[model samples]
Target: MTYSQERNKKMHSLLYKQRVLLEHTGKSSVFISNDSHKYYTNLLEYIEGDLERNIYTIPVLRKAIKTDSYEHLLKVVQFFSSNTSCLFDVKYCYELENMEYEDIQADEYTNYILYGTEPVTANGSEIEDFNPKYLSFYCIINMD
Candidate 1:
């Protein structure tokens, strides 16, 4: 089978598994099994390194994320997808700071304490904080 075909097959399998898990748990989102998460994390790390070097594209990256076999796959995919150019740029490592943790408490009595505030925007307004320098690099390669 071709590379594209293999990727498609993997994506399909992942989606199927996610659907089954959701149905069984009655949850709308995907939830990876503990063992699956550990297994997939190692796989994802390798794939992500390749992606950073521009050895992969959006579709291939999407397949990798879809086939993650872990709950963290969605977040990993989003992070890489959002910064495709960063793969080639070694100077800028993608970072997400101050992410709000998802609520897991089963009790209904506790009020949800919103931990993080959403960024707001005003018409024709700009906000800039330049403490952390951000840079990305890319290179042209000829495959012959």
Candidate 2:
């Protein structure tokens, strides 16, 4: 399948379900109260001008972590699944050096790492990387 086709499939499959969406593109989902929109928007706009846009968005992303719980984060992704703005693409973060997918699937200790994504996990040879921004969250705002 073409890239777009696969992307569409992934979005369709995940968005409809009560799950989180993370892709190889390093885009992930995040949810925040409507009141927090301004703050998030400003941060995103500022980071857009930075050379290391992804790296700098870490602070914003961290704030999101505190704002949305693991379960709610997944729900947010589902809410914006069809939102073209919220691709819910995840950014690369850390990885489980020695942990296997099967091992961590049920491990409560690795809950943070498994917050988002289904078929895609820190399992296999995937290196977990920091997903600093909610690309999908941008969809909720008007991009000038």
Candidate 3:
């Protein structure tokens, strides 16, 4: 598929996950069984990189947050998606699980977190401060 088509597919999937899929589970952290994982993992095979540089990751998280947290994730993803950028560390990342590339032969994968934050705006006003961050996404990514 062309780049535009690829991007649009990712957009549709992200929107489904953000609005439909997760809503069904009714939880922030949803676990997928190994069997189910197999089905969905390849769905994003056309995606360029892992969640590390994935564009869909942050937007979903931003929309998930009720207010302040939304601003931070948006800003961070925007910067990290680029070559070099940061805005007062509006985002942060910690790998709850780690898998290596080589080890992935048997069981390994690339899961990198690039964090930074954006401003939470209210009526064109952006909130800038030390706001607590929350988990907005639990994605199954294949970092190619």
**What's the CA error at residue 21 for candidate 1, in Å?**
0.3
Using Cα atoms with residue i matched to residue i, what is each candidate's TM-score against the true structure? 0.25, 0.29, 0.25
lDDT of 2 by residue, 25-127 (tens): 1133344455443444433334333313223223354454344444543443333333543433433333333721222232322344456542233364432
User: Which residue runs of candidate 2 sit more than 4 Å off their true CA positions?
Assistant: 1-34, 55-60, 63-83, 86-88, 91-94, 97-144
Q: Show the lowest summed lDDT stretch of 10 residues, model 2.
A: 135-144
Residue 75, candidate 3: Cα error in Å is 18
Candidate 3 residue 87 Cα shift, in angstroms, is 23
Candidate lDDT values, in order = 0.33, 0.36, 0.33
Query: Candidate 1, residues 21-134: lDDT per residue as tens digits?
Result: 334543322333544454334434445334323344333534554553333553443332233212221111212247321212212111112332222122212223412222
Question: Which candidate order results from sorting by TM-score in descending order?
Answer: 2, 1, 3
Better of 2 and 3 by lDDT: 2
lDDT of 1 at 7: 59
Q: On a 0 to 1 TM-score scale, where does candidate 3 land against the true structure?
A: 0.25
